[model samples]
Target: MAKTGEADADAFVEWFRAAAPYIHAFRGKTFVLAFGGDSLLRPDFVDLVYDINLLNALGVRLVLVHGVRPQVEERISEEAQYVRGRRVTDAATLEHVKDAVGSVRVDLESLLSVGLPNTPMAGAEIRVASGNYVTAQPAGVVDGVDLLFTGEVRKVAVAAIRDRLAAGEIVLLSPIGYSPTGEVFNLTLEEVATHAAMALEADKLVFILDHGDTVDAQGRRVSRLTASQAQRLLKELPEGDMKLYLPFAAQACKKGVGKAHLVSADVDGALLMELFTHAGVGTMVTRMSVENIRPAGIDDVGGILSVIEPLETEGVLVRRSRERLEQEIDNFFVDELDGRIVGCVALYSFAEVRAGEMACLAVDPTFRRGGRGDGLLAAVEEAAREQGLKHIFVLTTRTAHWFIERGFVLGGPDDLPAPRKAMYNWQRRSKVLVKDLEAA
Candidate 1:
């Protein structure tokens, strides 16, 4: 590295240029990002605010759910009763959950008050409301244990949240809900998001949590899974033990909530990283096969869109403009069924080195099990080969197993070609899978 005199202003330009297309695709989509108390109240909270400001400026609709379990517990006396080995909620505990969740919302709004291009997020903007959207019922009994005032989601006012988001409001949903019969209950952030996703029919239902432990048959953590797979995995979890957060995610996905993301609370910029770049940070659970894969044609913009609209609602794939995809048309491929476009994949390439990246690989659900993904993959690989490239790679978080089965193996960040690296955004940490087609 030369003297720090030469800043990579040029690199930033190239960086945004490379990312804007995909990022713009998500501009108006509803994305629910659940931030944990740990991440929110971290010492370096200013950095997090900056991230939020950036998200706002980019025009992404934001809905935030914050956790305050520690604060709630600390205030609860050492004498508070425990029922069935869980915190027994008394009058004091419920109030504290309200306070903790309230303080978090106030503090977050306060943080935003201090920064950003347009602080419409505050008073001059529409007032932010927290309660009532989540009409809840008591999480009455757990494992024969009497739980007091622990609210479980009964219904979500999807229309209300949707109206606000459509009006360009950043929705802040603190983990506090109103119950029927005029009572309030403390709800888990996961429960809130699950019901919200299902209600909003959100494009993406994501959880930024302290722990996750979903794995495939192999040793690797399967980062992407379908709702069915997630449900199957959930059923395997012992009753009253919902550790992975996949069951609710699967519930949301099955309910047409779109894609569900479970990621580390500690992974700063995980949201941005997942949305903006190819390499993403966490496990994404969706309801479809060939996630983000699809079939397209020059004249079938409507057809391409017809396939994407349903998935878009569930948030499995971010939405993009027909014109934009057309501009990048040469990068796309199709799955032909007697000349009908039943499946498609898009290949984004680094032409300087003749290397290419595969994206948007999808086939009709009925056409699945007919070797569509494999066939399309072969076609793309052949195209890459025809371009005189020696290797082609896929960056995926969940489907690494599928790629591994097809001769691709895990690769580190440095293993990526330099040009591609220039386009990598640190937020996503999208995992890489590579296969070599060159001969010795």
Candidate 2:
């Protein structure tokens, strides 16, 4: 039994170590967590709170937006009608909305304030701050039906929220906004969450969905999508909780939120798994293609160095100084993943020979096996073709097989363009390989 316990401990240590990069990436980043009131009724809600406390401990600034839909229904004893996505909050329903939102606010504050021994909050001193952070305007009539007390977020007090967050407080936003004239109006949590993320320029907007996972038409689970892809997929998804959150996620992305995540509140530690793991437990939506292959900018020098330095040390790549990289920065193309340069290749065009030399091809060690290297090569080849080059060549000592497998053929030094031949390093004795760009 003791040996088994030791083995389990070792596995856990390894898993924790693997999550270190995510931890570093999220530290000091602001995340807006949104959920419906129904989620609070689940048996696992306490566990979700514990996970939230864990995030807070890790230095993540949090703004929690919760919808009181179920609670409002319970207060009114009927389902509220929504026309064109705006709830028709009549005068009678507005009273229920106030009661429901107030009750939820108190409950969430009480839960987050817990500090009992032997609990997740035992030593946690989490400060929950709630206020009139969201300014509102009446949603108005849609096709002749007045929304009455229903409202939409017109503005968010970003400065005040930032102040609270700077002081290590979690800002809690109930789906209740106040007009400039001091009238309270019922708000939709989705709209509030989306606008808040935009106003705050948050790193992420997370929706705790009832549905656990997202799948495509073929029933295959999808783990990531760009905003454009999400918009296109939304048209095909069935009417469910996931579908309901898709538009809001896309809107958040459009307004510059770094990413939006849809994770099930039903799953224990789902938020942790989605944020800290490489293959997230839920679907991630981003504003643009997270993996971008484009021309490297002058600012990419540091990232380029980080990707190739190890390869240089291993003698797999030739050493290039920072000054040299700066001079040739325009010739380099990089594969940027989530804003990090993970792979790069430089295309040195030989206009006289109608040929290009692919050099300094490198991918970060951690990301090498994931086809980022292939993406960089494809990008460089396309760029060469655009520049009217008919052939592209590479001189590699260690990655010859990689180039060869990608359709490059063996060639001698004499096959190189005259200018390139003069600069060939005989000491390295690297093998030359070339590919015809116009070939099928």
Candidate 3:
């Protein structure tokens, strides 16, 4: 029992230490968490609240936008009519919508206010703020049906929300919007969250759904996608909550939001796991390709140094001075992620032999598992081919097998071109591997 307790304590400390970077990264940043009323009905709602309190404690500016669709359905006896996913809100249904929205708003506010001793909320002082932050215009006469009070988000009060956030208050928004003409409009949870994140340029726009992470056609959980890829996947996905919310996530990414996430309310601590960990428990959508390979410029010398310096110290990569790197920057291709260069490879062509030497291939240790090395290598190969080179080769002391696995063949120094062979480091005795570009 003592050993088990010690092991558990060590694990907890390690986990907390691992999350420190993310904590520092997210502090003072804004996140918009959106969910349906179905989330409040779940047994895990208390757990979600606890996590939200933790985020608040960590200094994350939060905007909580909730939908009352399920709550409104429970209040109305008649069947609901929908045209193109917007509820056909008549006079009677509009009243029910208002009641449900008000009830949900109060319930959320009360839950966020909890501070009982010995509980997760103990000593946690959370102030909840809610107001007319969303402006809406009614979706009038869609498909010949008067969608009376069903509305679309016209604008979000960015200044008002920022004021609350600056005051250290958690801003709450209901799916109920008020117009300038003194009329109320019912909005969708997706639209409100999307617009608010866009308007605030929030760091993350997260949707807590009833299901787990988004899956592919083979039922495999997908971890990351670009906006274009998500749009392509949307056509194949069946009609469900994931399908319904995916477009909103993609739209937010394309508009201006840093990243959009679709996480499961069913999974405990899904929000924390998704935001703090490298391998999140949800699917993330970005604006475009997350890993971009582009020709290296003079400005990329420092980033390239950051990636290759550790390997140079370890003797896996040859040492190059900053001046040398700057001069050869034009021959390098870098893999950039979120504006940071994570990987790089350089192609030096030998016109005498119509061949290129791929060198200085290194990826940041943190990003080594994402196939970025392969991407960087592909960029070099393509560049070599474009320059009319017939073959490409690499000299690696530690990563011979990695290159061999990627179609490179082991060779002796005699196989190298005259210029490269003369410059080969005999002291390192690195293994030379060559690949035929035409065959590839």
Candidate 4:
């Protein structure tokens, strides 16, 4: 029998191998990490700092932004004078904000400076840099309430930040900005992080919130969301950390930041898990549709075949030769996710009869339950309508009920256009289902 220590070592080796791909993917990429001030009070914050150091050691350029609301509240005697989410920073409040922000900055800097021997950060020569990297303008007044020193991010010193990142130093940003006239203004950490990401065109923007996973209406944790979907969900959610961070995540995506992530600060090693795993432990938001459906190109022939070959062997789909697929590639549509085609359908128009035949609808078994098959069918139908086809039909030995549930009706082979009927495989004994475009 294998010793327990040996077995544990084997597991560690396997897990490290699995994380290698992510480490390679993130190398040389820039990431902006923002956290609430309350996170620093947690015991696991030191572990988080270690994770950040690990990321830097792996060659990921880092920008850190932190909020100080909780810290400021602790320092101030009258918490009622300021709002929780949106603080109206008067002279007294601004002083507390400065003190809180400064103290947090120092604490974070000191944490990152640790290099004690035999510890996780041993020999980690991590250098952190901070400066007047954010320019600000007063928020002025809203709802007739003068938000004295409360300001919004007007600009980010992208060049200076880039220079520091290039020098292998972590850029730290406080929830504070400086005006042209040298006045210090209190800023929102979310705004600062978002603007900095957009200005630098960073690869990712990550928000470490005080909560765990974001749940849907059914209370199921949502793993991913497109910008539009996140916006809609935000409207329905009450005022909370998810609601606060989602808009910034969506804005980062819209402004061309490659990806935005929301992870729970309460979970130890959440950042590392989210960054280094294939399926992250938190919600990820992107600009548009996560899986894009578009016309197939010549290069996608292999992926298309891979998706359909299993179904063809199982007799769920008719087999097509590589040559045939290459020739008819222009008529194919594929649902591509992270460069892999997980779903595909082909549309053949019988223009003489103002009708079309939908064929070869197949989605990877792993993705079938995710509605990709429905999306491909819809795409094919839309293409048919665009070509002025009056109706569309499908021939299937199986999946008849699936199509029927999606608006297709039972139809005889005789209803098919003459050209399509002539090409139908009599030996296959497939059922003909049709749907009218106008009726749909």
Per-candidate clashes come to 22, 0, 0, 0
Q: For residues 1-440, could you state the per-residue lDDT of candidate 3 as single tens digits?
A: 99999999999998898789889989999999999889999987988998999999999999999989889999999999999877898889989999999899999998998898977769989999899999999989988998999998999999999999999999999998899999999899899999999999998999998854577766777677777778889888866678889999999988989899999887889899999876688888877553398899999999999999999999999999999999999999988988899898999999689889999999899987655776677678778989999989889999997887567899989989987889888999999999998876
Query: After superposing candidate 2, which stretches have Cα over 4 Å from the reference?
Result: 290-440
**Overall local distance difference test of candidate 1:** 0.68
Cα RMSDs, all models? 12.2, 9.8, 8.9, 11.4
**Model 3 Cα displacement at 311 (Å)?**
11
Per-residue accuracy of model 4 over 6-79 as CA lDDT, tens digit each: 99999899779878977898898999999999889988888889999999999999999999988988877875
lDDT of 1 by residue, 1-440 (tens): 55343457666786687578767777887777775676665775566666665676667777777777766766776666656544566677888887887787888877765644544333333334455788877767787877887767888887888888877777888776886688887777777877777777788887765543334434345555666667666655543222447677777877887678876555667666666654366667766543333335477666656655665565544457888877877787776555456777777777776667776666667677655676678668767887887778776655676776567779976767797788765666667888886630
Candidate 3 structure lDDT = 0.88
For lDDT, the strongest prediction is 3
| Candidate 3 stretches greater than 4 Å from native | 290-440
Candidate 2, 140-206: lDDT as tens digits: 8888999988988889999999999999999999898999898989888988999999999999999
The order by descending lDDT is 3, 4, 2, 1
The lDDT values for all models are 0.68, 0.87, 0.88, 0.88
Q: Considering summed lDDT, which 10 consecutive residues are worst modelled in model 3?
A: 211-220
Using TM-score as the measure, the top candidate is 3
Lowest summed-lDDT stretch of 10 residues in model 2?
211-220
